[model samples]
Target chain A: MGDEVSSNQQEPEMSQLKPDPIGRTALAVEITNRLRQMILEGVMQPGEKINEKALTTQFGVSRTPLREALKVLAAEGLLELIPHRGAVITRQSEAEIAEVFHVLAALEGLAGELTAQVASDAELAQITAMTEELRQSYAQTDRPRYFRINQAIHQEILAASGNDTLVKSHELLAHRVQRARYQANLTPQRWRAAVEEHEAIAKALAARDAETTSRLMRDHLLQKLTSIRVKS
Target chain B: MGDEVSSNQQEPEMSQLKPDPIGRTALAVEITNRLRQMILEGVMQPGEKINEKALTTQFGVSRTPLREALKVLAAEGLLELIPHRGAVITRQSEAEIAEVFHVLAALEGLAGELTAQVASDAELAQITAMTEELRQSYAQTDRPRYFRINQAIHQEILAASGNDTLVKSHELLAHRVQRARYQANLTPQRWRAAVEEHEAIAKALAARDAETTSRLMRDHLLQKLTSIRVKS
Candidate 1:
């Protein structure tokens, strides 16, 4: 399982595009994505050592690249590295987790405003489709499928915002506050409540009401935070 | 020069507090801070190799600790690690520079709102003092001095907001968009104009006007972006 996970993360193409060029950035990005996935997927438990030698071997690279990858992960708040010891995956305290949600609320609120201001007919239709898909998945009791659609809905809104910088910042915040067990651990009641929140955001978007959409999106995120905080 | 930089960064107390008996987060933090300072101080330029062997020797540590330290630095967006090669500093482009300012404008706008909502008398006074220092620096054409005071004023606002998460997010944005030269190269006339913008923000804060303060802060950042874009 470890081998498969690490092997699939072969360094991004830009790493080899130039001969002996500044490949660290590419390496860092490759590392960042892989680490993010591992944390979110629960492949490596939080606060694991991220064993440099093991990773170097598993990823078919040397310490240099592995270390670089660790750095990138750290930037996203996935991995934490010690000065003299080495790197390990990071774990969030309950308070820190709440902090992440607060930032998420702001970023998503910004994204909602931009999306309402710019979403096209096609985009709105796509969101509507995803919303339906999520509803169907929930009915089928397919947690993973429901979650995927839920994410797609959010991502669609973010992409429609016409602001790449905002999108990237939001992504960073999302990864930092990894939703590892967020939906997986949801009660049926909580799940239904979340779907209702999504519907509110979609309806606001369809109305092209930036104020309502922004407020609804913020409320949606805050609702999740409140749920997660209480449970944590 | 490298040796001097390393010597000054040797913080011994990082070993004293192990928050978790088995965890190494404190170590990661120490390394992160040291590397962040190196990058921010320009001792480590973008795209420079962060050789583990050399770093290990310099700090009188083994590869294990050094690698861990590198991971923390990478996460902070200071280093880029290549799979086969090694870590190097990250470089910014003209477009990226612009994107950063756009994000900064929104973030500072948020900060301004929070600061206005909750500025203590002491905090407001500090901001006023910093603005005065900035004015003095402007009169003397002291760019470095002016920059320090300018940063102090901004930090005071961030601090007054009493949101650690917001402050950290803003710090990340600032670090990611580390283009000091963009502000440094501004013509003296433009610098003075910026100082005047600071005056507006300070006045709004003094009046405890949240809406005006937030609007003026957003405008201040936008003006900076416009000036830099024009110059670039």
Candidate 2:
């Protein structure tokens, strides 16, 4: 683990990641974001012990700021600080995954409801275009492209909701299970159904049917959970 | 009697107030909940400067844990940490109140739908009974009793959702606006309407009408927001 960080830089954009004179708190926050990205991208695997030494060197930071970053993540339930072993990525159990998804379903359902009511025409059109692009990516069998477009669809719904706190709360839970979400490999039948679900969401949202949009958003997430469960 | 703002040392009704803990972090968490309760109960007025000395004495803790507790509250947007001057409770703007209540409505709507689907017969019976009791409290013109039972009804619905994460997320937002929720001085007609809404919610939930239950829950909260806005 230590050798991995020492031998390879985690982010390609690390050259621009210089610690500022603004003090350790800001630096700690920067590291927290970088580390969170790492976790989301699966650069840091769950249950793996954190390589403090390598991160310190990679970020050109002292151990103090790096550890502070770890503490913040620990507080968010992303990392676990052990007595003797230092920080280990918290391995979420099945129950934890289900719990987070359940809340996320509700939050996304709210996003759908609000988006249906208030999304600008331009935003609705863009969401419709994104849904089309997601389908094309699926047709191309480009998983990474599909994943990016898929996430953009969800983010678009949240942004259209025009509720920052709700967006933030949804993002927090989404981050907790992001790795699982992106990694979910569905069977062909399930994949087709998932794409259809996204199309239905975009259509219902376009029709300004708040109830159908909300229900579709929720059921979409619950169906996605099955794929995540299959993958794990 | 005195010019002391937060000198209300809490009367007999709060018998479960004192929280002695074994560790600093636990003490800080306990103090956080205690402080949150104080804010909700209006013991600490929004925009009023915190009296550190008084809180330290009241909580029987040193400055360290109390300050830690204050920081947690600040992070939750319930308090603002000023430079040189101490903490001040965050005075929620009308916009902020509306935003929080909007999200709360969605969360409670989800709770209603889930409870309608999953609540035990005993739980629904209890909720129906609580609604009757709430009506009795109103009939007796006991505002305090009505307040307690009203909150209990909401709590019972959340409990019946069978999703702890949903409960916690809802609660985090609920605590943010609880003072507004409780302090809203409704007109007599509005109060009666509020009770009628609760009755409709209970009846819909009992009938397992998930969509109606969800919409009623959302509408009930939106109606409550009008009262809170009027109060402020």
Candidate 3:
């Protein structure tokens, strides 16, 4: 929660969010967004404690806005606040992870169904390209890059769904497990299976087979959970 | 934003959460939860601006924690923060409302599927009883009571899903549209259709007809949006 607090969040726009000048809510929102990014990126480990003084000092802010950021994260289920004490990034139990995966599967399944029914040809082509890119990443064994591309493909489908709330809700639950996914090394067999699954999903989506696309998308996410559990 | 802010938020549990006694994070969480409840309960109207000073004075706190609550609400899509100014409760557009209903339908669709597959006899009976109660409220033309029972039946299904994340995610999206539902006076025709839909949903659940339950649940929510739009 100090210098290690992911300066990737410290974009030029973020630096301009000085407190009091623009107002507290703006800065608080900025901090909340950045913290959410850090947690999702796995730069901040699950169950890692935040030293309030260090984080405030690191962000060049006071305790108030930092506390505000923590509150927002807690509501998002990305952080846990201990009563009368500081907070920690949340760690999901195996059962909790399974529950979240089930919900995400439903979200992605709906996204696929909607995308098949309405996505433009360009959107379908972009998803196909990402699926191909995901295959390329498979040979390299770079887990983070592969995971990022995989997420980009699902995100593309969600965007095509034309429902912002669907995307937001999916990401909120996805963030809870993305860190685990970033760290969980996949077995070679499972990696091949996931890649194959993506190929089938892309084909179904391109064919505009809404029901098949929906079922494939749902199965894809559930399989991801299976892979994580297998590897762990 | 003062007395009109809803004293119902000031439960005995809430009064115990003073800023200094239990710590900043705890107080912030309390304020965020209560604010969320107010928004959902329709005590806080959409498009209503939060008077930070008046709310702080009323809640007997400083601006720091109250501002913290605002940040959290903004993230949940229940509030919008204006740059340099404070925030206001979010008002959904017709388009936005449609988008949210689609997602909530997907969520409740999954909930119905899971509940059909796994919910115990007791849980199913309880849900059926709520459905009967909903019918009773319909006869009385008590909109709130009917709406509350309608939500309870849905909540019972979500609870029976055994997926806490599913329940949490559904509520987050449901909150976005619930204020509108509470105020949208339904036509008798639409009301009768909704009641019929619930009866069918309960029958599907009782018979363990997963596909029908899932389809019925999704259609039920979308039809609710249709009802609201019809009345408006």
Worst 10-residue stretch by lDDT in candidate 1 chain A? Answer: A1-10
TM-score of chain A of each: 0.83, 0.84, 0.83
- Candidate 1 vs candidate 3: which has greater TM-score? 3
**What residue runs in model 2 are displaced by over 4 Å at the alpha carbon?**
A1-25, A38-75, A79-91, B1-25, B43-71, B79-89
Model 1 / residue B125 / CA error / Å = 3.3
The whole-model lDDT of each prediction reads: 0.73, 0.82, 0.83
* Alpha-carbon deviation at A80 in model 1, angstroms: 3.0
lDDT of 1 by residue, A1-232 (tens): 2234334444543554553555344554576577678778778766566677877777776777566566667666676656566666665556677767766776787778778888898898788778888888888989879877888888889899877767778788887676533633577888898888888888888888888888788778877877776573
The alpha-carbon deviation from the true structure for residue A62 of candidate 3, after best TM-score superposition, in angstroms, is 1.5
Instruction: Using lDDT, give the best candidate's number.
Output: 3
lDDT of 3 by residue, A50-70 (tens): 788987887888888788788
Query: Scoring each candidate complex against the real one, what DockQ results?
Result: 0.21, 0.13, 0.32
Per-candidate TM equals 0.70, 0.78, 0.84
Provide the lDDT at B125 for model 1: 82
Q: Give the per-residue lDDT of model 2 (tens digit) for A1-232.
A: 2243233533343232443333434565688789989987878777677879988999999987677577667656688765445777766667679878988998898899999999999999999999999999989988889888998999999999988778877877898998877677768888789899999999998899998999999999999887788774
RMSD of candidate 3 to the truth, in angstroms, is 9.8
Best model per DockQ: 3
